[model samples]
Target: MRSRPELHGTNGAVSSTHWLASAAGAAAFDRGGNAFDAAATAAFVIQVVEPHLNGPAGDTPIMVYDAAAEEVKVVCGQGPMPSAATVGAFRERGLAEVPASGLLPACVPGAFGAWLRVVGRYGRLPIADVLAPAIRYAEDGYPLLPNASRMISALAPLFRDEWTESGATYLNGGRAPKPGARVRNPILARTFQRILDEAKARTSNREAQAEAAIDIFYEGFVAEAIDDFMATAKPLDSTGSRNAGLLTGADMAAWRPVVEDPVVVGYRGLLVHKPGPWSQGPVFLQQLALLEGFDLKEFGFGSADHLHTVVECAKLAFADREAWYGDPNHADVPIAALLDPEYSAARRALISGAPSSILRPGSPGGRVPWVPSFAPSSTATDGPDWLAELGEGIPAIMRLTASTGDTTCISATDREGNMVVATPSGGWLKSSPVVPGLGFPLGTRGQMALLAEGHNNVLAPGKRPRTTLSPTLVCTDDGRPYLAFGTPGGDQQDQWTLNFFLNHVDFGMSPQQAIEAATFHSEHVPTSFSPRQSFPLGVSVEDGIPETAIAELRRRGHQVRVTPAMSLGKVCATGARSDGGVFAAASPRGEQAYGVAR
Candidate 1:
């Protein structure tokens, strides 16, 4: 059962991982803001509330559908490797892969720049208007959710012992705030205020003002603070050692988010859109391609047969993602051939009755199939079964991040027919020290890059690390924008999204039903994070998938891990209809996610 009712609005609808952030988007729409305005507002609010999951120092890849232009464009908010970040630099440290958390994995902060682009180009409101909610939340204080409080508490020991700046930022009086307790971040508030103040000075045009704010972040005080901190400090990283970051002011100044066409695929009757190879987004389309030939609805949604077929397809697609997906600008990505109908049919032919316990990335268009060098000895898992002691009903937001890792998502659609779905992630508080006086930390996205030579994702200056932050947009059969959806799980983002999309498209479920349904995903391919492990034929199913189904899956030579019904995915979605109605839904698995409309 869904915890809350689906919100229907004729004018607009918004959904996000945090209730207040949803309200912020709704409030923007109430002020006559367009979808971009509403989404930008909510995105900032998420940074303040879901600090453990994302921050201003994080990255966001956004999908925007402009009703006037009748086109969908992607804002590539992911930052690139610093100019000083070279494979040789990492090799000098004797590291096989970038450390999961620290300066070593830091990238140019992109969240602020991405938000600026959204408001300046597509939004009806000024940059200051879009950021008001976040500023108020930061300065006046907001009730901290249990998920945020718990994340802080869990990492409090590390902060206290090593990363004191983070401890000072997250803890109050050196203690994690209780759930629902009022919390404030005066420093973060000042940071936003400073940007707004700079933007206000460039009163010539709204776009100019927004660009001024971006300059302040990338070229002004913000950049200075970050450079100064990294130059002087040697903070503890995931390797249990101190390392200074290689990112410099030049990297920040040289970086700017760009707009690009989304990677597109025709799946069944819908036209699916995703970010390019810089993210794992294309894997969703690849999975769809592999599953298209199957009689999906005949097996019935949630059935063991349906589950097995989809899970198997996921493994095949993710294996390809591991082998071939990377920064298309930096690497020669054979995406066109990978998405070809003939190629998908060939990949589909590989699926059989019993599960294949191996990573099998097919040769696309006769090119050699790419594979990583380091193979994990054990099955890969993305969970913190040990954290169950945190108590019952701890929001899946924390578990989603702690278990598999986390990010934050926002979906919005306005009466004007414009839509935006953005997945903003990276720079978790646990990743590194909070920049002094900046109230946020740099992103650890560098961890996604491989250290091995000859690999496409190997560390290189100005190249984007292949990120797991994938947002999705889909169009109706007739080519009109239909739905925008995404989730927060690292590798599982595409898997959970595919599951939810199939529920709605194939099973005829409503937006809320699609999100509320139990979800599952496969870990059969390599994960994006360090150690880059794969689990031959591993599948994780939520508890609601019947015991008989689990038994059948195991019988099919699958290693099945069972989780609580709602513990698998933290997803939020918004849908638009030709009838001028908008629908919004958020996963109730974690009470943090909410859908709001009026």
Candidate 2:
């Protein structure tokens, strides 16, 4: 049974990982804004409410379906490495890989710029109007989430002892705030207010105001603050040592988010749109390609055969992601050949009843696949992760980052068939020290890059890291915008969201039912974050799954572990219903995600 009612409306619908964020989107819709405006509003609110999962200095890959243009485009807000970020630098530090935390792995923050572009290009609202709710939440205070409080409490010592600015921002008078307690970040509020003031003072045009806000953030005050912080702050990193960040004010000024065509693939009369090889987005399309050959409906939903087949297929696709996906501007990713029917068909032939113990990346188009040979998995970060006690993070759900933080998701749609899904992640309080006076941390996204030469994702200046932030857009076979959906949980994002999508498509379940249904995923591929790790044969099953199915999976040589019911993903979705209504759904897992429509 669904924990909440299905959200349906002909006017507008929005879904996000946090209730307040979703409410903000609903408010935006009420303010006579379009889906793009509502989504941008919610994305900023998510940065404030889900601070542990994302920050202003983080990254988000936005998938947008514009009704007027009748086109689907991806505004990639993922920042590239600083000009100084090179493999030789890590080698000089005597490190084989990038550290999980601290300034050394910092990248030009792309989220703020991305949202600015949204407000300028697609949204009807001004930048100040779109940012109002988040500024209010930060200034007047919003209730602290249980998970956020737990993360703060766990890192209290590290914050107080070392990351003083973070302590000042997160801790209440040197004490961790209890969960659900009202919390405020005046510094962040002031920073945002300053940007607004500067923008309004300089421009009267809405789009020009958005551009001015971008200048305040990237080429102006925000970048200066980040530069001052990174220049002197050598905080503890995953290497268990202090290191300064390579990101500079110039790097911040040099980067801008891009709006480009999406990587498209067809599956069962639906056209799935994902970001390019710079992210793990294509991994989802690849999985669909492989599964297209299987008659999942014939095996029945949630059946033993169904679970085994999907899990095995996930392993094959994700392996390809690790080997091939990277910044297209800097790397020669054979994405076209990888997603081709013949290539996927050949890869699908490898999956059998017995699980494969090896991480197998296919050679697409006869090009040799390069899988990095790394040591066993390690979570050697600067801080203690309460993840085991909290039952979250990489080992449990597939680690998306090397640090203790995960990610967040937001999706929005309206009566006009406009849709948007933004997966914002990185720059966690646990990953890097907050910049003084800014109340946010620079993202450590560069850690996802390999230091080894010859690999496409190897550490390089101006290259975007191959992030696991994958948001999805689905369209009808004829190209009408259908759904915008995504989730958190790092490497598990695609896995869990795919399960939810399949639940709706193959099982004939409603959006809410699909979200409420038990979810599962495989961690059989190498992790994308720092301290890259892999579990070659492990398949996590939610408790609600059938006992017979679990037994069958185990008997098939799958290392199946029964996780807490609904512990897997925090997926949110907004879609156009056949009845011409906008429908939305959110995962009730952890009581975090929410959906609203009217």
What is the clash tally of candidate 1? 2
Model 2: per-residue lDDT, tens digit, 385-478? 5322121222222233222227888999999898999999887676688999898988888878888788988889999988999999999999
**TM match of model 2 to true structure:** 0.96
Question: Which 10 consecutive residues of model 2 have the lowest summed lDDT?
Answer: 389-398
Top model number, TM-score:
2
Q: Give the TM-score of each candidate.
A: 0.95, 0.96
CA lDDT of every candidate: 0.84, 0.85
Regions more than 4 Å wrong, model 1 = 1-3, 375-405
